[model samples]
Target chain A: MTGTGSISDIEPRLGYSLRVNGRDHEVDGAWVGDSLLRVLRDRLGLSGSKNACEQGECGSCSVRLDGRLVCSCLVLAATAVGREITTIEGIAPEDGLTDVQDAMVTEGAVQCGFCTPGLVMAIHDLLDRNPAPTALETREAISGNLCRCTGYGRIFAAVDSTVASRRDAAS
Target chain B: MSVAIPETLEEALQVAAADPEVQVLAGGTDLMVEVNFGYRRPASVCALHRIAELHAQRQDDGEVVIGAMTTYHDMERGVIAAALPGLAQAGRTVGSPQIRNAGTVGGNLATASPAGDTLPVLMALDSTVVVASVAGRREVPISDFLVGPKRNALGPGELIVEVRVPHLRGPQEFLKVGARNAMVIAVCSLALVVDLERRRVACALGSVGPTVLRAFEAEERAAQEIDWQTGRLGDPAFAPEFGRLVAAAARPIDDHRSTAGYRRHAIGVLAERALRRSA
Candidate 1:
């Protein structure tokens, strides 16, 4: 990445700190044009968030910024300095997979697995907000996460099973 | 490139005013796409998400004043939805849950894409866009605010502060014809609004013109032929007439998403459907 000369001549490397997965990490010597997704995977060594479409169209880079689902690819690394960001790696338990993750494996929803992390993040967001989302709601929630394999039937099934299991456990 | 994350609107305005070439970042939905695609490489950026004033919303009299930073997710629920159902409906159709969470109404308006889902609704509602600079502020009507495809009336060193839309006592409807149900840009869209108090009907068409186009003749005809008391069309024939007139007002082109002929036909159908549903 060639710098613009004038701005880069003064400071070719910019430094900032970000709170990620309940931990603070200081990122140094990053370009101003780098996105949060780029910084996370390349600088912070956090690869749970996949960088599929750098544009906001695909949810492969989905993460929770301030507890709201957003594409990390669209977030400027400089702008996310003091915000709370939760990526797919942050959703797991200390020892086991989350309910959504477990269901994805059991229901054969991990065919290609490229979109799993983002799907997990989106599903977690949906169920966190609506414990019992309808089929259409489930589809609408994860519409951004595109999976070429499984035809999304198994994903939907996994979401249903997770919802049912959680309800039963609660009762 | 230099980046400034301003926490206050005044500070943001000062930064922006100091450098007219500085790019104002709001949600980074549209701008980031350009950056990612290598279409834009801004030398300086002024991020506004940290500013509290640009994220506020309030109601004054019968108008809904929505802060520029309000996201599509915000518009899908609560007071904004109740006050402007058409805007809410349009907002719900924008992108996906992830995109909606980060994409702001201000970004949508500032980007001023011809296919922006909410532009038609704002035009139909006669919304006013409030833009601010360190010098002062000014309100531009929605029609004048959108000058052309992917262009707006925002001046140098100016940033969108908020949008003020009249909360009318009426039934409003927004309809879009896209390639698919989800995550698709509109080929053509229409928003219809009936003001009960003023006994007026207004309609706006999107993606079928250089910018969002208001169907002035169709609105006038619908206003004249509709029964104010019953909130129904005085004559059923007026529905098709309204559709034809709305289609006539559109200046669509053959693009990758759709053909000019298809967009013209779709706009007419959507306009008719919107009117029928609202009535």
Candidate 2:
């Protein structure tokens, strides 16, 4: 199986199954040129991943494809067939914010909240790879994620506190 | 519109051979931007990232063969980084971690952008680009592969398979001047490779010409001026002199990114710094 599943009965250029947030979703009638970001939000109705810059310059459309962080705006929806996709909606706990999200809320890292979802994704990716990323490492990891609000000082603080609390919980 | 996600290199080549106009998507860093901006409306796309052979890399004899689909994230660390430090350095300067994870080295070469980070390093490493079509495979020297700004030598059905680079035997450096440290394109860049085994020095300049350029005069002069045994320049003044020669070889233009004069001057300074850093 090429894993595209089936073509649209109505149209020639559409149809694919994307395993997103641990569920297989049959996406139909999406434009062949539509981005993964557009499909995830418009087709799958997962609107948590923001759409700011259609280009990859902005991380507002960031998501994890098989655990690697990538800008969904740059990924073609059809090409993503059979790949595991995780969005901001998938990252949240069933009842409340993750530790990283809680830290951001408590630290006032979010101001406008447009860049928050991507930042949250990026932060979790960093900590998952490096449980104790240094200040410089943390900044470098999220350098792709730009937040005009709060000037990023609060964001850094939030990441630091998350690391500290994670360490405390472990001990 | 149709999308062909070929599982094998042969399948991909056949897809391209049948439809020469089929747009190829590797990492989507450059191409997707065009797609997003509506600059390109591809009737068909051949996504090659799924072909496992395109992502394989191996060390053979004295050279490292890197598959075309190798991501910048792959180049950033592990065996590839250790074998090709200058390539690693250049790769690290690419867009962001997100971009690196998705952007492939072949995409950079195929795009053939003069500002492409990996070009100068590949040139300095004396690399060869291996491209294949249904007919057969051919190897083109890096210099010949990159014909001009944002242009390459890829034929109608040909696709890059691998890049063969000699294992580093000595100090190498890649440096660039950008508007900001991260996620910025190069205004001007330099790659310096000191081959202690061959007692040779090669330097390539980027973003200061229509294509990545070898500073032949600079390389020749530096080859004679350096002590191969110690990997040090015989004369301290040679570094600056080498910079002058490198800058003179460039054909920079007054683009929005930088003035031609500034590019020339920046490449000169960059050449000097890269040489000094290697020392």
Cα displacement (angstroms), candidate 1, residue A60, comes to 0.7
Q: Write the per-residue lDDT of candidate 2 for residues A1-171, one digit (tens) a residue.
A: 355655344324678899999999999877778899999999889998999888787798889998999999999999999799999999877988999999999999999899999999999999999999988898789988888878899999999999999999999
The number of clashing residue pairs in model 2 is: 0
Candidate 1 runs further than 4 Å off: A1-12
Q: Between which residue pairs do clashes occur in model 2?
A: none
Q: For model 1, report DockQ.
A: 0.69
Task: Enumerate residue pairs that collide in model 1.
Answer: none
Give me the displacement of residue B174 in model 1, in angstroms: 0.9
Kindly give the stretch of ten consecutive residues in candidate 2 chain B with the minimal lDDT sum: B227-236
CA error at residue A15 for candidate 2, angstroms: 1.1
Docking outcome class, model 2: medium
Candidate 1 lDDT by residue in tens digits, B1-279: 578998899998899889999988998988998887778877788998988878877889989999999999999998888889998999899889998998899999999999999999999999999999988999999999999999999999899999999999989999999977778899999999999999999999999989999999989999999899899988877888788999999999999999999999999999888888877
Name the best candidate (by TM-score). Answer: 1
Error of 2 at B110 (Å): 0.3
TM-score of each: 0.97, 0.96
